[model samples]
Target chain A: MAGLLLSPTEKVFILHGVQDDYRSDGRSNIDYRPMELETDVVSHASGSARLRLANTDILVGVKTEIDVPKPDKPDCGKLEFFVDCSANATPEFEGRGGEQLANSISNMMQKAYHSSQAFNLKQLCIFEGKQCWKLYIDILILECGGNLCDAVSLAVKAALFNTRIPFVKAALMDGGNIDLQLSDDPYDSKLLDVGSAPLLVTLCKIGDKCVVDPSAEEENCSVISLIVGLTGDRKYYYPKDADKQQSVESKCTTIGMNGPGSVAPKTLKDAINQGIVAAKSLDEALGQALLKERQQNIGIKKHSYGFLK
Target chain B: MPGPDLLSSQGLRLDGRRPNELRRIRCKLGVFTQPDGSAYLEQGNTKVLAAVYGPHQASKSKSTTEGVVVNCQYSMATFSTGERKNRPRGDRKSQEMSLHLRQALTAAIKTELYPRSQIDIYVEVLQADGGAYCAGVNAASLALIDAGIPLRAYACACSASMAWRNGEPEPLLDVGHVEEAAGGVVLTVASLPNTGSIALLEMSHRLHMDYFKVVLSRAMQGCRDIEIILDKAVRDHLAEGWTKQDVVTI
Candidate 1:
């Protein structure tokens, strides 16, 4: 942020490029920067991933702990997101400089993942209203390229997919106290079903068009952008013999067009449509990549090239 | 020491390293295109990335007519260790590290060459196992070279821990987290290995004055070895002509 400065003419040039469906880096409007993702990079975390999206580098580690379920949501668990923007990215981000950006990103992610349709908290529950698993998703921003939301969400999704929760053996007492035992073998764990987890996609509205995954230059050119959080298929669960009836379309499975931006109704509509298409394709590609990585892990053919290696 | 069990009867320390062996160092220069200079270094499990910017106009109050202002900042990742840290910088420990880094780097940099300018060197520890300070120094040195900064020498840092073996004091080079946590006296030295002059030296815990010479010399030797490895890496990086920017400049 400190060293990356663009002249007025350069900003205009980038804006014009976005309007013409081309980016400064020769990428299309919806094209993402070349990215590399690796999972299980940190041995200490329950789940870990490192993602490099162009110059932006992000690492996410998910730790699991036991806690009592909330009385209102007795059957569900809890999730907390913390983002640490390290000074390594830039000297300007030293001290508490990046705190505002980090807070904003973390807040946006929390809102995106708030709805039950985005994640199934029931899977994290260990006992009904007694004990539950709480997930601490810690995100470390190593470097800031541009479009931090998109990159962080993608890394978080990949890390969540890579997370393994140890299976708990529990016994219930007459007083309703549950005793739990976790497996000693590290490999003996349960993988989360994060297929429906949402991934944030930022659409930077340049001259007259919107570009996905804008570079730093492109970001400096734009005035405002819309963040869209799109999820894959989500299955609704109900208790046995419940009187209520629900349908898939009734839940409104998508959340789009967020952030501080004002747009024409027509352009907003177009952006939403574009966002849905982009999210679907992105989700599919992410799924394929994650599945391939998981297969490689199973075959012992993958080596985690973390920062050290 | 636990009465000197750092080295076992089988002649192996924790993490399976000999008394004088250093951790494997893998490094890459010019990892990023944004910074004027960038380098990534990994010492065993600890990983550090350093980026250099400037020789440009100095910020207000920092400019001096005599020489360039060499500014440095050191930070660590929240999830870099077993326990998650709440904050990465602005802490007392990080401030001390920043000061230490500035002292060592200022000694190596030819500040008089660029008058009334500022150079910013930033080191970020992505993963911290042990010897993070040493890794930061080495990585920043590479970054300075990549940025074409004139330096007296390649500034190298290494830590030596003293433990009694066979009733004789032995200093372990490049101590890892396990060894460091064992609570032995650790002497960290940053120096110009060729000149054999110390840039910065810090000691934590206590050591007898009689044994200080041995421990300090051992740390200096480790720095010399690191310089050899880093020199080879720089040469290999340059030989490959992997720096595409050179083509544009040419």
Candidate 2:
């Protein structure tokens, strides 16, 4: 969404609309535009998901590897985030042109997934201090409409939810060596527990008001935006345990801001609260969609509609 | 001759395809609005996206008085292959692929028509199951057409491999990742099928001079077949009302 061209009159109109709590497209301040999500799209990766929010297209693939646990964090595995902005999105991103933007997004995502409350790294542990699973989450930006961080986070969460770790038996051999064996059965794997995976929500400040999921026009009008990453309730991901579900408050894992505009403390607090509400609703909807797809998969072969559809 | 068990006893190559058959090709043009032209193409398991920009004024250093400068880049997503890739581009293999793309596309483009100008073609591979270069070339060709750039002919690329059935040698068309890794001679060709001229030709591994003609011919035949599929796609795209803007060509 490189500098969209809009006359002064258009910007003012968008500003007035934001002040009135009604966007030009008739969306309220906290409403997000419709988005489509699909999982297990890439056959090569261990897990994959594609998210389309308006014109923004994000594809995330999760690949797993076996590695020795860190000397300090012997009980935890590793997680790495890499973001690639493809030239297909915009020619301006060609050949290292988009590196700066890519680095920022990946760094922010890394920070978001750092908190233990957001993602549990201990589940990836194989043999305590000996070995663990390292997950590589690669995000590819095919098209950019606006609000890239939100789309990428959602896509990555879905990809993680779709990821599977094969069952491995580790045996401690004589002296200090470890021998690992993987079962031959394809079903000998377990799905990753991603109930508390964080989702990012961007709040664009326009005309003294904050709005969620701003369009490119609104993005161009706003000088500042705040991105909040918050955790979702575990009950939604595991509906079978609804009777025993516990009520947990959503927690913020990371908060970031962009643009040169200054924010008042009061407005910043209010915007962060607004972002949390928006993220919870998004999480609920995503959980429902993913669960429904899982239900459908059990009855028959899941027909993958990749880019063709 | 085909090495290893690349060919089953029934004479069918790996992945259940005859030696002369190609993988299924599916393509769509104008997938993105930001670029001057864009296309998404999937040849069997391989998927690629291509975008085209310019015929705008060339950068000062790249401009030439005789013809337009053609620039190409080839990149793959880090998660596109079986093993995760650490970087997307700026590698030796990707650089060579970019050079090969520029060579094939430059031949079909009417570069002399736009003097002192430039055209940029960028290809991104979303999934790679072998023949990534050929898929990139095909996708870029469509992107060029979507941009409505004038061309001598559609520059199509395809790969062929040498396999043995019974006592005779067979040329496998549109080799997949399995057959490619089976250690056989793979001959890749990019050609202007309409003009019956080869734009670029590359081969890896060993092959007898006597069988070289057959392998080259098989790859060329594949290009011709791909040209037909691409032509039909362009026609369908036009019929679906992409002609709102006049495709004015010089």
Candidate 3:
């Protein structure tokens, strides 16, 4: 939005397009742009993913560290989100310029994943309040076209899905202190249950209608946008459970409105419902992509397509 | 350090490459549409992305008649290392890296042509296995070329480490994270290989003065090798970015 400038007539053009339920890019009001995702791209981190939604590029890496659980929530593990707005995205993001946007996105993700129904932190617990795995989810904003919140959340979830927490080979609790041994073998690890991970859907309000996946020009034309974080169903992430009667339903875990303009209660409700629908379809596609990637790594070594492809 | 050795009896490094073999360098130019030029490069497992903004009008305060001002920022992802980093940039180490990157890149760009202009180069390390600085320089070079910035030559950077194989000191090319952590001496060199001149040279962990030349030469050789690879990538990118045009000679 900083570099992109649209004239009054250009803004009107976008507004009319949104009102017609068709966008400048020929997408419907509820449709998202084509997205490309790949998991396990970074070798340094335990789990990593790169997601490119049109021109917005996001790379997320999940690093697991052993630490003592908090006294208040000893049974639960820690999930900390750190967002880095790289200058590669835009010059305005250079140095500490992007810190404000980065903090807002990270905080939104933190609030979204805070609910137990959204992400089960107990799976990261190692020795029942003594020690647990602390996942440091670091999201790097490499490029930004628009709709950064949605891209970051999707990449985070994919990285979490690819994350593997090593099993505790040995543990010893000594008066107020604990020592734990983790297996170094890469295979001696457990995959996280990220099926219920939250996905954020940003609906930009242009004119009186809402549009999903707004481009940079559309973003500048809109005065306000709502980011809805919805919980994904386990059956979507794990296809093995797809055969069973679907019991889990999509739920709104968090709702965040960004911008100076405000939304009416009626429009907000409709936007929330629209977000839920968009999230489900997005989740289904992401699940299929992750499953396909997992199957590809079954018998042979994965020739990583990191940035080469 | 005592038990795990950097080199085995077969003269192979820990990552299975020969002492003088550089890592597999795979690179692509113009990976993004936002920046004037952007590239993504992976040297072994260390991946880097670089974006070049402009040689446009310099800011009022920074404007000068001397030449183009080269501004560089080097940052690594928080999860790029074995341990999660607290911040991506602005740390002492990354700030030093930023200066070093500017030093290396400034030597290659033709600054005199763009008087009172500024070129901003931003390098982001997505995964730093080792020799992250070298990878950053190489990626930035590609991005600069993609941006169509005139340069003296291709700026390439590489690192070398001394590994003892069968009681002999063997200079290893493209040091990896494990070897760097093995208490070995690492010598990093950023050079314009075609110009046959060094732009920046840095060494960490003391090494014998007698073995310094061998390690330095290894790193320079690595730079030359990397330059060739980057040149090919640039050529490939140009061919891809071009679209067929019908001849119009009226």
Full ranking by DockQ: 3, 2, 1
Q: Order of all candidates by lDDT, from best down to worst?
A: 2, 3, 1
Contacts from the true interface found in each model, as a fraction, amount to 0.44, 0.67, 0.88
lDDT of 3 by residue, B116-180 (tens): 99999999998898999999999999999888899999999999988776667788899888888
User: What is residue B118's positional error in candidate 1, in angstroms?
Assistant: 2.0
Give the clashing residue pairs of candidate 1, or none.
none
Q: Which portions of model 3 miss their true places by more than 4 Å?
A: A242-245, B1-5, B164-169, B243-250
Stretches > 4 Å off in candidate 1: A1-25, A169-181, A233-261, A299-301, A307-309, B244-250
User: Mind giving the per-residue lDDT tens digits that candidate 2 earns over A90-201?
Assistant: 7788899999999999999999999999999999999889889999999999888899999999999999999988898546576776888876565679999999999999
Weakest 10 consecutive residues of candidate 1 chain B by summed lDDT: B241-250
Residue A176, model 2: lDDT of: 78
Residue runs of model 2 more than 4 Å from their true location after superposition: A169-174, B1-4, B242-250
A1-309, model 3: which lDDT tens digit per residue? 768767898888888988999788888898988889999888889999999998889999999888889999999999999999999989889899999999999999999999999999999888776878899999999888799999999999999999988887887878878777889899899999999999999999888788888888888988899999999988877877678847578888998888899889999988888888899999898988999889889978778887777
- Pairs clashing within candidate 3: none
Tell me the lDDT of model 2 at A306: 71
Per-residue lDDT tens digits for candidate 1, residues B1-250, read: 5538788866677878988888999998887655678889989888888989888889879899899999888988776777877677778988999999999999999999988899999898877988999999999999899888999999999999987778878888998888888888889999999788999999999888998999998999999999999999999989978652343310
